[model samples]
Target: MPGQLQIAVLPSTNPRLGIVFALYPSTELSSPEVASMGMTLPSVPRTHELPPVPPDAPFIARERLLSLDVFRGLTVAGMLLVNNPGTWSHIFPPLEHAEWNGWTPTDLIFPFFLFIAGITTHLSLSSRRARGDSERAIRDQIIRRGALIFLFGFLVNGFPYFAWANVAGIPDPTFLQRVLDRLMHWRIMGVLQRIGIAYMVAALLTRKTTLRQQVVILASLLFGYWIVMTALPVPGEGTIGALLLDRAPRTMEAWVDRVVLDWTRFGMGNHIWVGGVTWDPEGILSTIPAIATAMLGNLAGRWIGQRRPLTERLSGLFAGGALAMMIGLMWNWVFPINKSLWTSSYVVFTAGLACISLATIMWIVDFQKVRGWTRPAVIYGVNPIVAFVGSGVMARCIYSIIKVPYDGKRVAIQSAIYQAGYASWLSPRLASLAFALSFVLLWYVILSLLHKRGIILKV
Candidate 1:
């Protein structure tokens, strides 16, 4: 699940400063793996081709790509930076999400991770096939992993639900009612949830298909989504008016979210939180295009894993990325390139950017063999699930779970720390940036230690 970090404010004793600092985790760290919670295991070899092994044999490891790790690490670091601002309200323009349309550096993070997942999926599956695993065995592994990833997202979404009563300072509450409330309004789809869904679908689609077939599927998904979103008449709206799509609740995406994940069926209405009404950016309809995003990654993975020369691989990636960006921009004339919608244009544009970004990293890290500066990103990249999940949980605990008394009132520990430790010395935006940077640095230290200890937490 994309970790949703909510920021709350505390009343301060100082009369001059009305809102001293915002506290808590900011927003979703939606990724496949949660941090530090997975069991320690030996590092998997980068590449391997063992003799035919029994079906019951432990899954053979594939060659781990340093560029992929570094790319993933860079994405995770960006996730942390954008998510853990000192004060959510006072963030730099680049870090904040666009109001409704357009894109930001922050918007690229999720898709980049998804792209990496696609690449890794191809590499991993191919490695298993090389080791003589049957199609059934590989398919089972995909299903199991996908289900577990979805389950993890669900758990994170509902984390500490029971403890809400305590956090809210409710002395006593009807236990059953609390449980019912939590269950009734739980968010069904999120960052990790989307990843799991896209991963499963893309993996299955690419599992048996050739590159040409995969490309066809990708095109079909994007075009189909565009047509549905733009042409189909929304239930209540008179005609298929583009203007009607202005409000999120009026769009087809929100309608599907209502029908599929509607809380009213459970006697609640405000269960999900895209626009906090009826829409979710990571809702079902948007996931169609998201799957295309993953497929694009799969194509890239296939290209990278081919027996071609390094220059050829990089050239193909760069050319593909440029072409995708051009096509996306052309489509943006009609589609407007919105991230929340995960519009066809958005998918291609973001995926294009991801490709170029990854290619640049690969060129430097792999082609040039200049790897010294990649250590930080590699560390975060190697343990993304841990970094994302751990940071998210920690932020939630600091913001919501743990409380500290300040000026005769209990305040969130995050706010208190931010105000005293950061806001005291820095401006609000700088302080927020500092806090976020500190969070990233802290995780680097933790992940670096894990890397040193050979503790990889792969799902």
Candidate 2:
């Protein structure tokens, strides 16, 4: 197949000669090969020495940005910390999600990951296109990956389907009935499911469009969502006022989720929020703006990929982030920055924060060449899919699947451990924090070993 190709020269004992040639296909060069070549492959683009190409070069060869991986590692670490507290009931304020409108530090993790997914989508797709991958091949990959991610999430949600020992005098049902119940009540939407949808949409939108067109599409999504959410009258509310009409069960977003997902089918109703409202925070309507979040990340990826000075790129990122924040805050006056709604304002605000955070990390880690403290984060970053899926399954096992005898009654193994190990002496909040920290450390150790062995589970 015809495509753009790059050959990298490796150092040899003889200064004048190259020992090996590293071939990078447009899609992705495996980490082991990159490590062997002694190059730190960041998600950002870097200059390369290549043979002269004709005017119609099908691909662009670029260096990876180290900062992107560091940023991803930091985000995943934050996810583990917030998600695995000793007791969800006793979590620190920062670790807990905001009730409805405002956002906490905890809220940032999911959006940040989605944003990163968008950035990587652009990088990976561009590489494949340059490798002469057919349009059909690329589309199939995007759809298949998205589907697998969603399916993984669904399986995780229904993990360890039923406990053999019954509780509360409830009669034991047949095994087939148990399976049926799990399938019927399983959550249709969740963190990974939303990510899958957002990533797929963002990839398709940016696949062919120019930067100018992407910007226009992004603006339209945000503005269009704001109008639909605020101007349209909610079913029960009977009238539309942005403030009065935009709360949990009364909002249009929730109504759509209920109608499409059906409250009766799931029996549990909407499970995304704290209240018993029949609405998911990551519902169908809100996913529209979430796509904008990824699109914004795609824009950042493109900017970073440009052949420009690092200083110039950093400046552009910071300046763009500040501008986005200002616009987001301005929009928030009318459409409050509600994470539940995934409001247009919230998308702009969170994306702005992501850009600024990434730029700072780039400045310190990439430009300043700080290497000592980055190893842990880099380890976590390279194997993010592993960390996320593994940690999630482990948490579910601790929280629900395993039960232990406690004070003459069966209790969740996690609770028993918390009560006996940490909560016995420490205060509630402190105990919770300690447990969360321990979870993060455990995952770090696992990820570190994987990194040392040059194993990365790419999804």
Candidate 3:
């Protein structure tokens, strides 16, 4: 019984219900503790290492991968942890985004999510094809789903749809005018927007292409982006893009963001990132390499879908990932591994790390058959959009939208909570970490309930 896998059937929105398996020490599948651990599959670490099956034994024709779910859950959990610290002013170095170039642990999270998106795209499309779905149906689904995701991101950007609570120069203005002002200044691109765009383009591009053809397309994207970024001149700046890289606002990407997204000439004001009015981290030109990152994951998914032994697949992933890391590092010397730019080197490097991380998780959960501790991640992974959108909206309300009287002055609810509950007794850094951990735990409770009810939100 020690090495035997335990199976649990859960309802799913997909026609194929999700079948999950875990290796437990006993056969008490219905125990309260076991029931608490829920995961959905549609669907991590250091050694750079890494299932087929019988019918009714977890791997049916539309079997789900527990490891993929676990990996995605972990990434989403990490996003929540990093994004919701008690105070951004006091945080650990690794948890923080690199100021400009290079990467910290935080930098890897977005690319990891995108890479996983690419893998699932491949797996999902394959499953649909196996079910006798026509290519036209598949294409329509891709476009519709991709558009919906982008719409969700767009909506989140302009959430609450309310006027600013405070404006420096404006006296009390009409509510309609204030609302219009907010609309005019709403941001146009962000993490989810970029993810939707990259996933849609990468999926469509690889939908009908052969393995060799996908590789060629990937190569063109990375190399072509590198050439454009390093060789092309910034129109009015009269300088190559590479030369302007250090000056964030002067880069070609920033120029494009300003030109297309900023509507000041038409009185709509800027729609780029509020942090950088002239630029956006998830800018247009940089997305070319982001697509490459997703395609790399598509290639890995193809490899996993092969009929080879598990060991063979593991070896392929490890070897290929290591080779990619080396190549990306070599490329980094020229382009720099920049998260903001989503540079060519950053794409390859992060995708390689994603491969290695997923391979490691597979080895643990699948090859070794040890997954008892994977439930929290599984919960977060299954309903990522809910976590992302819900958390984003909640943060806005608590951090800025709602306020309370504090020290005879108004302060955001989150700030009041931090000052009272966390900052009162703990060091600044400790308090920040505690608040973030608490936020993660709170979401875990919410997601676990949904997971228990077999409710998964899929776009």
Best by TM-score: 3
401-444 per-residue lDDT for model 2 (tens digits): 78899878999999999899999999999999999999999999
Give the Cα error of residue 418 in candidate 2, in Å: 1.0
TM-score-based ranking: 3, 2, 1
TM-score, per-candidate, Cα-based:
0.84, 0.85, 0.88
**Residue-wise lDDT of candidate 1 within 390-419, one digit each (tens)?**
888888888777899976888889989999
Give the number of the best model, judged by lDDT.
3
Model 2 superposed RMSD (Cα): 6.4
Which ranges in model 2 have alpha carbons more than 4 Å from their true place? 1-62, 163-170, 241-246, 263-277
Candidate 3 stretches with Cα past 4 Å from truth are 1-63
Candidate 3 has its poorest 10 consecutive residues by lDDT at 22-31
Lowest summed lDDT across 10 adjacent residues in model 2 is found at: 16-25
